[model samples]
Target: MTLDFDQICALLPHAYPFVLIDRAVEVVPGQSITALKNVTGTEPFVQGHFPRRALMPGVLMIEAAAQACCLMMLAGHPSPKPLYALGRVERFRFRSPVRPGDQLVVTAKADKVVSTAAIAEVVCRVGEVEVASGRLSFGQVGSA
Candidate 1:
């Protein structure tokens, strides 16, 4: 099954410009997820990233991965999904530059999950090139 924009909005607390991924192509509850992001020249950041050359910021790739990880973490939860905030990033590597018109395929697989925290292995790729890979950790946003 796939999650469209509206369904993604329902499960996530993000809105336009902030919500990175465009579609959830595959989801396996707490185990893993794969999403897509189609970069465009009209994206807000593109105009300013560079006047002559525009490339996707590495930081945003990581953010996209984190968001995908959160979706993987949330898919298995009961109704009224809990909110999770990125807590840590580890062993991340950027392999290539992402540019507008590229489609980023982000896949996140859960490493560990508990009541308050979860960890995931995430990778983002543009066709045959791996753009970024990392491990991300998340914690429930409102929990104490």
Candidate 2:
């Protein structure tokens, strides 16, 4: 399954460049999804993140991972809810700098899914190299 910006906004609370993810290229219910994020110089963060060489922040890369998880959650249901309280991140490492125009492939796999929460192992990559990897925890809200 794939989602556009309006659909994404309906699922997640983040807006504009903060939304991080642009779309889901692949999705499997309660299993995994791969989402894409297009980092651009036009993004607001670029203005202050660096004066001339704009690099996407490490935290935003993690946000992209979370967005991929959100898409996976949405793909499973007739209706979906926003994920709340990003519990923790473990073993997160930024291997390379993500620059403007880089296409970030964020992939997430559900390690566990329950009534109240879900846990996933997530990663961000560019081509063949791993850019970031970590475990992400999510709490499901009642509604979007």
Candidate 3:
């Protein structure tokens, strides 16, 4: 299944400037998801991250990965209010810098899933090169 921008906005708790993902091109309900994030030169963070060189923050990549996992997890429970949140990130490595005009392909696959929590492995890439990889744990929040 594919989730468009509006659909993502509804599922992701982050608003406007904080929403890290663009769209989800593939989703396997509670199993996995593949999402896309377009990095642009004019993004607010890139302007202040450096004067001459613009590198997307590694934390944002992890956030994006977490969002991908949340999307996958949420896809299975479409009627509920948003609850899952990134609880932890483990064994994550940033292999290269993310630059403007680059498209990040983030794929997350479930490693474990429970009623209130989940763990997923995430990998982000640009073209054929890997940018980051790790495992993320998520926990239900907000009245779960």
Candidate 4:
């Protein structure tokens, strides 16, 4: 299924300057998801990350991946709302720098899921180039 910006806004708790995923390109409930983020010079981080040559921060890349995984995990749930918390991030690697004007395609695939927690492998790419990748563990918080 495809999720547009409005749908994504409803699914995630993040807001402007923090909502990393721009759109859900593809989503397979309880399995996988692909999301996009259009990098731009106007982004707040660019102002200080490097005034001369702006680059997307590595941490934000992982945050984007984590958010994608959270969406993937929530897709199959009966209740549409639930807060997800990042429990762990492992084996993260950044192979290339993501710059302004780059369109990031982030994908997350489920590795395991239990009563309250789930794990997924995530990767971020700009076209054919892999920029970052890692595994993320998250869990439902409070009431569904």
Best by lDDT: 3
Residues 1-144 of candidate 3 have per-residue lDDT tens digits of 999989998888778798889999999989999999999998889878876999999999999899888889877584656588788889999999999999999999999999889999999999999999999998998732
For residues 1-144, what per-residue lDDT tens digits would candidate 2 score against the true structure?
Answer: 777767777777667657877888777877898888888888888898998889998988888898778778766576445456677788899999999878999999999998677999998998888989999998876566
Better of 1 and 3 by lDDT: 3
Each model's TM-score, in the order given?
A: 0.94, 0.90, 0.95, 0.95
Ranked by TM-score from best down, the candidates are 3, 4, 1, 2
Q: Which stretches of candidate 2 lie over 4 Å from their true place?
A: 80-82
> What is the C-alpha RMSD, rounded to one decimal, of candidate 4?
1.2
Superposed by TM-score, candidate 3 places the C-alpha of residue 48 at a distance from the truth, in angstroms, of 1.3
lDDT of 1 by residue, 1-144 (tens): 578777777788888889998899999988899999999998888888887799988889988898888778776578667888999999999999999889999999999989878999998999989889999999997621
Q: How close is candidate 3 to the true structure, as a TM-score?
A: 0.95
- Model 4 scores a C-alpha lDDT of 0.89
Give the range of the ten consecutive residues with the poorest summed lDDT in model 3.
73-82
* Residue 27 lDDT (model 1): 91
Residue 61 CA error for candidate 4 (Å)?
A: 0.2
Residue 34 displacement (Å), model 1? 0.7
TM-score-better candidate, 1 vs 2: 1
lDDT of each: 0.87, 0.82, 0.90, 0.89
Give the C-alpha lDDT of model 3: 0.90
Which 10 residues in a row give candidate 1 its minimum summed lDDT? 72-81
